[model samples]
Target: MKITEQEVHSVAEIARLELTQEEGQKITHALQVILEQTEALKRLEISKVKPTVYVLPLQNVFSEDQLDKCLTQEQALGNAPEVEKGCFKVPRII
Candidate 1:
């Protein structure tokens, strides 16, 4: 499918994009190519293929979360430039 200049301009307006005439032409051509490729892909034979989310094999590789010895308040705030009531203190924000 070919994307027209007017169609590109309307799409850009809806998307709030500011495209020059040259940019609009480039985008239109790219969109047309993408549409053609998608249409060609629709003709592929996949009757026996399963509709899977991932193209490759998937596996979980994460380790179980474990807690370690944590720092004391004084040790945690020791590097702060300012400390008050055993905690780091900073300028107030609205």
Candidate 2:
């Protein structure tokens, strides 16, 4: 697939980038090469291959949940910069 310099320029506009004519030409050629490689991949035979979320055979690694001692409310707000009504107070974010 051939990408045009105009298309590259449009992308630059969307990304708020300022590019020289040389940079636009380079980006256009690079995008064309990348698209061609993907197009070539469409001809590969992979009907029997299974799709995977990752390359590895991943398994759940989480440990079983167990009851544990809990901290008091004061402990949680101990190192807070500001406290109001026994709770941490942070600047309102509008």
Candidate whose TM-score is highest: 2
Q: Using Cα atoms with residue i matched to residue i, what is each candidate's TM-score against the true structure?
A: 0.46, 0.48
Residue pairs in collision within model 1: none
In candidate 1, what are the lDDT values of residues 1-94, reduced to their tens digit?
A: 6679889999899999999999999999989988888998679998988898987797786877998889999789989999999877999979
Task: Give the local distance difference test score of model 2.
Answer: 0.89
- How much does each candidate deviate from the true structure in C-alpha RMSD? 8.4, 7.3
lDDT of all the models against the reference?
A: 0.89, 0.89
Please give me the total number of clashing residue pairs in predicted model 2: 0
Off by over 4 Å in 2: 48-94
- lDDT per residue, candidate 2, 1-94, as tens digits? 6789998999899999999999998888888989998998779898988887788777887867998878788898899998999889999878
- In candidate 2, what residue range of length 10 has the lowest lDDT sum? 55-64
Clashes of 1: 0
Segments in model 1 whose C-alpha atoms lie over 4 Å from true places: 46-94
